[model samples]
Target chain A: MDLINSVTFKDLKAPLFIAWQINSECNLGCLHCCEEAGHPMPDQMHKDQIFNFLRQIIELKIPYVALSGGEPLLHPQFFEICEFLRQFNISLKVETNGEFIDRNLAKIFARLKFRSVQISLDGATKDTHERLRLRGDWNKTVSACKALIEEKVNTEIVFVPTKFNIHEIGELIDLAYSLGVWGVYTGKIMRIGRAAKNWDILCPSDEEYDVFFAVLNKKIAQYDGRMKVYYYPYDVIEELKYRLRYPSASLLVIPNGKVKLIGPLPFICGDLRKHSLIQVWENYKQAWSNPKVVEFAKKVIEEPWLVSEANDWIELYH
Target chain B: MVFTAHTKIREEKFGAVIFETLKEKIFITNRTGKDILNLLQKGSTLEEIVDTLVNSYSAPITNIRNDVTNFINQLKDNSILTR
Candidate 1:
């Protein structure tokens, strides 16, 4: 049948999507931030360099781009970058903390017609959310969602299921639905960034995660496509399945513009500044065949804890 | 007639995935359907496709012809296969 769909993993000649981390800068000090991003990093790319990168991405004709960071909106020229990328007809998804999204920002996003803006909303209540996100203001986030929804900007919620907010999974979904979000995405807290330091406090126990997933599954069934609910690490299984059907399907770009096979893995394919998009992609594909990378991928699959211990491995290897 | 210039096809285990980049549409088809598409990709005519399928498959010629016709019509309707 004629299915109106975006580019699938199988259709891509190179990488299907690029997760572009504009900068390692975030306003809030979230305990579970995988990048450990809070203050603006000194090495953040200049506006001109970002524009050049966007031009190269367009030239390479990458179909999908996910703008992320400490907070992508924190980039001085965030809207300018988005506008530049829009010129090349790239489908865009922005991941943000939602604090920066006001009525004006919502209008800008609606005008741009972005694919979706995924905002983090860890809990249903202020206390629960702030417990993990630290200085996160619940009302501001709620208002941002409402404004985005009202402006008809495609909005999604990201809820990282941690010990503090695991019990609030159902309530969070209800809250997202009430805010008229298109989806609610959640995943296990990876042991990276500040989360690695606070693993004992932040990481949920196996049983806790199991219970949380069960609740999520039930809610997904209840919603039944009224709203989308996605859980990561678990969803990585779907990626593995897709890989079985079509080989060579994913890539990750860190804040420093280095291409990696996985976010946590220290294996660097190539730096975007030095290499062309195709060169970086070829390097990534080549790394997939490297014995070290292959073995690492295998080990990560076999021992899930390896992902949590990625920072240590990176230090040892890099 | 041939598949549109914007359309690209990739073989999958169970079927083939057809992507229309212009419209951003994806079409997944069965092996038999994929077989037809493979032939069409190299600029095969309806008669040629039917003849090839007759040789390759055990189905009755009339049934194969009817199915191929319907499939081609569907592709055309979807602007996947174009003149």
Candidate 2:
């Protein structure tokens, strides 16, 4: 099948990918967490509602679904939801911190055949990793990697480059490669959520970012096909362009069941509870014409800093 | 030369999407490239491909032959085609 064909402007009724924030609950309060998710929010959608939404997702024929959040694994019915998604042959990807993954959980993931499981590993050692992750234990993450690799899970590591861990980028990539991971995704920390409050400390300087990418590009070229390494915002521009061409290419379903284009952007397309997924999709399509969304797109391209400042859009639009 | 067994080609509105599953590489082509790929999939010979394109398009036979040959050689280099 044509992979690019899957991404087109012709389809407004279906989205190419859905970023489903299962719940705003996480065990670790990482310094760079965009959602600032730690405790389980009371307003999260219930199990039945999520299942109903999944049914709508299948009916709409969405090709890919990324289960994200503070951490999706913390959801009470996480496995049940994965099993349900599997029944419909939907491609699944999960974003997690890797702390919850043990031998048993790794086995479950392998058996389910997830397209990819991206685990956050910000630093090479406990001192560096825990510095940003706060409650994270580097040893546990290493053990989780071993377990997942043992089960032959298609595992990938996510490295959020910050001032605290910027020096360890090379070491971290080597570590991920040694752990038998299929890919390593590293990106500059966006100034949002908890990171926003600590931007001065957490954000790397422009020169630091340029140096980091230079080294990362060399490493990626050297490794070639052995393991893939991607730098975010840099890599995401293509996806953003695709979204600009077809505004409905992505749909972010928040913890409370409200859909938005990019999570930080304040535009509410529709609430899953009140509207069917199809109706929500139509609302998303309608959003492209909204003067605010159009303006936001223009500003995003011209003023890159606006991406880091979520609330700034609120001020500009509201 | 024949298209590799692992290569999968799909026709798209703009052109064609060719995937080499073994290499996990995807290539997109223009309308003429798509037509060339379609002919290759049907096991057409190099000369036949040139002849077909010459008939379908307004291009001269000599130019069509050169382009088809270059295209096939490029695909072969990329491992999308094999003997």
Candidate 3:
């Protein structure tokens, strides 16, 4: 039913969802590493800090949370954090490399009723996948996916289209189908961190992208909802500007509790350690109009130096 | 009778999130709408869905039917579901 009077993102008190980088460490520093995550950061949040912010999550009644990492499973208290969030009425999801998901972990995911588990696979074939990720990781990840799918864990494959792997999307779709995955999410690799450093070599040409999407669309129609296809073909600048107007709707929470508007642009709007989630959201809303942010966005569009500030958290003066 | 090829329905604690991948649009559903979508996913026909809602919910049969029909129509209008 349509509403009588509508409230949009501007009117929201808290974020609709959160993309929380629970830890700065990751298993593989792949070509598309937005965080450029490798080892845990020096300022990584302590368990107390994370739990404190989670308390704020409950207080604000945030409905959805998508946990990520370097690899989220690498976080020491990962299961404890998941259990804490599950106690509340939060709809939880995870983005992982799928290296750590085993039969027992998959069973735990099923028991916890995770909304979705996104496992990244750059390509269908081992050579391409290994080239993008770690060698032998493709096999480990695919095995993890099989475990999760076997336990009916609502698993989805996350593919980042690039110059290296766009050609094999047809085979990738078939692989997802064979694995009985719930969905296939193919999103554009944004220009940030490692992606920015490797933009010349990594970004797919427009024609390459067109061909890739054509194959993807054909498979979508052929499968006919048997395997869901989710594609996000957004330009980094456009997506950043869109997030500016609607910052409160969804947020990116970095490992140390700093809130970033978008990954491609370096703008830290708030600190969860210092403020409540709502307060951080209010800070985020103002960050969009921050002259520094506008200048940075423009500068990145012109010069290619945003790479230096890629993973830097440029805290706003709010 | 079924969701569109790229359409996905993910249920949440508060309600459900419907993804229309063709346009990259997202729609949120309340408990009633979520239940209707769940039934549709389970291959329940329109009449079966209405009957089930009428029997379970305290609303009148006509009202339930009206709500279900409108919800289904919205899904169809958005190209999220098809026969």
The whole-model lDDT of each prediction reads 0.76, 0.77, 0.80
What TM-score does structure 2 among the candidates reach?
Answer: 0.76
Per-residue alpha-carbon lDDT of candidate 2 for residues B1-83, written as tens digits (9 for 90 to 100): 78774465656567765656434455667678888888887888988888877778897888888888887877888788994
State candidate 3's DockQ: 0.10
Error of 3 at A88 (Å): 1.3
Flag regions of model 1 displaced more than 4 Å: A1-12, A233-248, A299-305, A308-318, B1-83
Residue runs of model 2 more than 4 Å from their true location after superposition: A1-7, A10-12, A233-248, A297-318, B1-83
Error of 1 at A154 (Å): 0.9
Give interface RMSD (Å), model 1: 6.8
lDDT of 1 by residue, B1-83 (tens): 77764565666555576656444466777778778888888889989999999999899989888888988988888778884
Worst 10 residues of 2 chain A by lDDT: A309-318
Cα distance off (Å), candidate 1, residue B27: 6.2
Best by lDDT, which number? Answer: 3
- TM-score of candidate 1 on Cα atoms, chains taken together: 0.76
lDDT of 3 by residue, A18-77 (tens): 889998788787987777878897888898899998998887767678899888999999
Candidate achieving the largest TM-score: 3
Please identify which of the two predictions, 1 or 3, would achieve the higher lDDT against the true structure.
3
Poorest lDDT segment (10 consecutive residues) of candidate 3 chain A: A1-10
